[model samples]
Target: MTRLPPVPWTARADLAELVAALGPGNLRWVGGAVRDTLLGQPVKDVDAATPLLPEEVQHRLAATGLRSVPTGIAHGTITAVLAEGPVEVTTLRRDVATDGRHATVAFATEWRDDAARRDFTINALYADPVTLEISDYFGGLADLADRRVRFIGDPAERIREDHLRILRYYRFQARFGAELDPAAEAACAELAPTLKGLSRERVAAELLNLLGLSDPASTVARMDKAGVLPIALPERTPDGISLLSQVIAWEQAHAIAPDPLRRLAALLPADVRLADGAAARLRLSTAQRKRLSKAAGRGGDDAMDARALAYRLGMAEALDQMALTGGDPAPIVGWTVPAFPLKGGAIIARGIQAGPDVARILRMAEDRWVAEGFPDAGRATQLLEASIADAKIA
Candidate 1:
C-alpha cells in the first residue's frame, strides 16, 4: 500500500496552525502542494480544501488571530496570511452548472464530489495534513505514476464544462512530459472552436504558461496539428512554426530564457500588421505590443547597429529583434553602447539656424557618429563643423 507522505508541520508552523485551527475534519492540503510533494518537485503555493463554509472559515481564522482575506469567497476560497506564506483554503465545491467559461459551483461536504469536478485526475489529489493520508479519488496517483494526463471521466463532458481545459490539457503535458490521452486529444479537437469565446486574458495566460515550459515547440506543434493553435492565433503560419523551432533551438543554444512573445513573433505571419492583429487578439498590453512590434518588424542588419539601437529602443527590444532574426544575443548584450557626443546646442552654435532642420541635421550627424563606430569628441566636432560648412553653402 502506498501511504500518503506526512507533511512537515514543524517546518511550516503557519500551515500547521491554519489546518489545526480549522480542525482535522475541515482542512486538508490539496492541489499542487500535494502533487508536487509526491513528485519530489519544489512546491510554491499551499492550497487547501475544506468542508467549512466561507463565513465559518472567516470566523475560525479570525478567532485564531490569523488574517483571512476573501480572495474568492463565492468560490469558497479564503487566503490566510501568515509568516510562512498565504495558504488558499477553499471549501469543497461541486459544479452546479458550467458554461464554457465559468462554473456555477455549490459548496460540498464530500471530497469525492470536489475531486470529480476537476479537469485532470492528477490535479484532483487531496491529502490530510494531520493524518498524513493521501486521497486519490479519480486514480490520480495511477495517472501520475504512469506519466499520462487523462481527463477525469468523459473527455467531451469535462471539456464542455470549460473550453480552456483544451489548452490546459496540453500545457499540463508540456510541464510533465506526459503523453496526451488519445480520447482527450480527440475531444479537445472537437471542442477547440469554443476557444474564441474565452476572454483574451485567459487565453493569453494559458498560452504563455505553456510556452514557458521545456520543449514547448513539440507541444505547440501538436496543438497546431489539433486545430487549437489556429483558433488562438489566427495569424499562425506553417513557415512561422518552422522558424519557431529554430528560434527555440537558438534560445537553447544561447541559454536564453523562454520568451513567449518572441516565440509568438516567430510563429506569426511575418508581417507587423498581422503581428498587431495577433497581439490585439491576445489583448497584450501597450508595452507588450511595442516589444512584439519591434521584434516582428521588417528585418534590419541589426548585427552592425544593435548597440546603437539598444539606446534608441531598449536593450531588451533590440536583443529580442536580434534573436528573432537569428542573430547571436551574446555579443549584443555585452556591447558597450556609447552616447552621442553632440547635443542640439552644439548644432545650434554651428550657425546652422535653430529649428527642426537643426534637429534633423544633428540626427543625421548622430547617425554618422553611430555608423563610424562612435568617433572621438575631436572627430565628432570636425564632422559637425564640416556639416555646418556644407549647410552655409546651401
Candidate 2:
C-alpha cells in the first residue's frame, strides 16, 4: 500500500458509507485526482471508478442516504453529493464509438479496458480509495514518473477514435507533458484539421484550459508546429509564440496567475478588430470577449503607464495588459492609483445643470487632471475651473 494524501470527503459518514456500499475492492479513485496526487499537486475534483454499472452505483449510493445525479448516465457516470463534496462515480468502461466530440461507451468490469480507452496514460491512473495504492494497467505510472504523455495504444487509432484528442494531447502537454511523443505528434499533425469538425464551444473550452497552464508557450508552439492552431483559429499564426514566451516569463517573475484571455490575446494580432473576430469564432462569453478586446487594445498603447492603466482598467486587466505588452510589472505590483478629485456633483456646483452638460464638464476635467500628472487640490480646482470656462465658451 502506498501512502497518499488523505481523500478529504472520506471523513464524512455519508461518503464513507457510499464507499463501503460499493463493496470491498470495487470503488477506486480515478483520473485527475489520482494523477495529480501522484505529482504532489492539489486535487480539485474527486472521481472514482467501480465495476458496478450506473444503476448499481446509484442504488448503492442511495442506500447510504446519498442522492445520485445521473450526470452522464448513458456513459455510466453518476455524481453523488455528500456534505463534503460531490464525487463522480463512473463504472469501468471502453469506448464503443466516437466522432471527435461524443463517445459511445459500454461498461466493462475490468479496469484495464477502461484505462485503455482514456486519452493519455497519465490520466488513466487509478488508486485505492483507502489504501492509496495505484492501479497502472498501461504503464501509466512509468509515464507519470517520466513526465511523458503517450496514447495508450496505436496513435492513429486513438486519434481516429476522437479528433479532439489531438487538442487534448496538446492541452496535457501544456500541463504535465515534459516533451512531445514522436508518434503522437505525427498522428496529431496528420489529423489536425479534423479539429474544426468539433463544436466551437468544446474547442474554445479546451483552448482556454490549455492557455491557463502556468506556462504553455512551448506546447502552443508545438500546436502551431503541427498545423493545428490555424485550423481552429483561422486568422491566428505561430508568430506570437515568442511574444507569449516573454509575457509568461514576466508573469512568473511577478507572481501572477495565468489569465487565459491575456495569453490568448498575446497569440492574436495586435488589432482589436482581429481579436474580436477570434473571440466570436471561439464563442467567448460576453465578459471574456470584452476583457480580451480591452486587453488587446490597450496592450500596445505606450502612453498608458502602469499607474494610469491600473486606475482606468483596474488591477487585473491592467496587469494583463502589462504582461501582454512585455512591460515591467514590478513598478505597478504594489502601487496604488491616485483618485481624481472632480465629479459630476462638483461640476453641478459650478453652476452647470445635473444633466449631460455636467457629465461632459466632469469628463473634461478628469481628462485634464489625468493629463496634468494627477494634480493636487489646487491644480484640480484650476483644471475644473478651466473646463467650466471652456464649456461656457462653447
Candidate 3:
C-alpha cells in the first residue's frame, strides 16, 4: 500500500471540507489529484468519485450552502463551489457504450468498476479524503512510481474504446511518463491513423494541449517520428522538426506565456500551406486566426524590429507570434510606435474630401511622420498638409 504526499494548497482545505461533509462511504478523492499528489506535481483540479448519485452530491453540497453547478449532470459530474474554489464531484461511472470519441456511461456504486473503465493506469488512482489513505484497484500506484502510463486494460482494446487515448498516451508520456513503454508506443502507432476519423476541432484541441505541455517540441518530434502528427496536423512538413524543437525550448524556458494559439503559431512554418478554411475548421477564434496568419507572415525572427511589427499586430498577438517562432521576445520591450495625431474627420476639415484621396494622403503623412522619428502633433499636422498638397500636384 503506497502512500501519496500531502495535498498542496490547491487540494488540502477543499478536500478536507468535502470529505467531512460527504463522509467516507459516499466519496473519495479520485484521478489526477491523486496521481499528481503522488508525483509531487501541483494538483490543478480536485475530482472526487462517489457512490452517491450526481443529484445526491448536489443536494449534499446545497445543504452546506455551497453553490453547485450541474456541469455534467448527464455524465454524473457536479461542480461544488467551495470557498477555496470549485471542486468537481462525479459519481462513479462505467462505460456502457463508446464510439471512440463520445461515450455512454452508467453511474456505478462500486469504485473498482469506475477505475476499470478509465483509460490509463496512472489516471485510475484514488485516495480516501479523510484518512488520506491511497487506493490502487489497478496497480496505478506502482505505475505512478515507475513513471509508466500503461492502459487499464489491453492497449489495443483501450485505443479502440477511445481513439483520443492514442494522443493522450503520447501527451502523458511527455508530461508524466518520460520513458516510453514499447507496447503502449506500438499500440499508439498502430491506432494513429484512426485519429483521422476524429473531428478537426477535437484533433486540434488535443494537439494544442500536447504542444502546451512541457518539452512540447520533443513530444512533437516523437509524434512526427511515429507518423502521428501528419494524421493530426497534415499541414506540417518533415522540415518542421527543427522549428518545433526550437519553439518548445523557447516556451519551456519562458513559462509566462502558455496559450495554445501562440504554441501553434510557433510550430507552424512560414511556407507551410494551410487547408482552405483551416482556422474555421479548427474552430479557432477570429483573433487567433489573425494572429497565426500574422505570425506565419513574420517568420521565426524575434528581432526588435520584428517585435515592433508584432506590437503593431497586438501585444497578445505579438507575444504569441514570438512563442510560435521559437524566439525570445523580451528584447521587444519599451517599443513604442507613434499613432496618427489627426483623425480622418480632422483631415476632412482641411478641405480633404471623403474619398480614396483622403486615405492616400493620410497614409503618406503617417509614413513621413514615422520616418522623421515620430514628431509632435504640430509637426504631424504640418506634414499631413504638405503630403496632401504634394498628392494634389501628383
Give the TM-scores of the predictions, in the order they appear. 0.89, 0.89, 0.87
lDDT of 3 by residue, 217-313 (tens): 7777778788888788776656676766666667568655556666666556564236224566677777767766776766544444544554356
Model 2 C-alpha lDDT versus the unseen true structure: 0.82
Cα lDDT of all candidates, in order?
0.82, 0.82, 0.75
lDDT of 3 at 252: 62
The residue ranges of model 1 lying beyond 4 angstroms of the native Cα positions read 1-10, 334-354, 372-394
Predicted candidate 1 versus true structure: per-residue lDDT over 1-394, tens digit per residue: 4555554532587787887788767887788887878887878898989988989999999998999899999789899998878988899999999998999999999999999999899899888776667889989999889888899999999988999999999999888746668898899888899998999999999988887776788888889998999998788887877888888888788888778877878887667787887888799999888788777774764456666667677777776777677776775666776777889899767566678878777777777677777789998888777666665535
| After superposition, candidate 2 runs with Cα above 4 Å error | 1-15, 334-343, 369-386
Clashes of each: 0, 0, 1
RMSD to the true structure for each prediction, in A, is 2.8, 2.8, 3.2
Query: In candidate 3, residue 24 scores what lDDT?
Result: 57
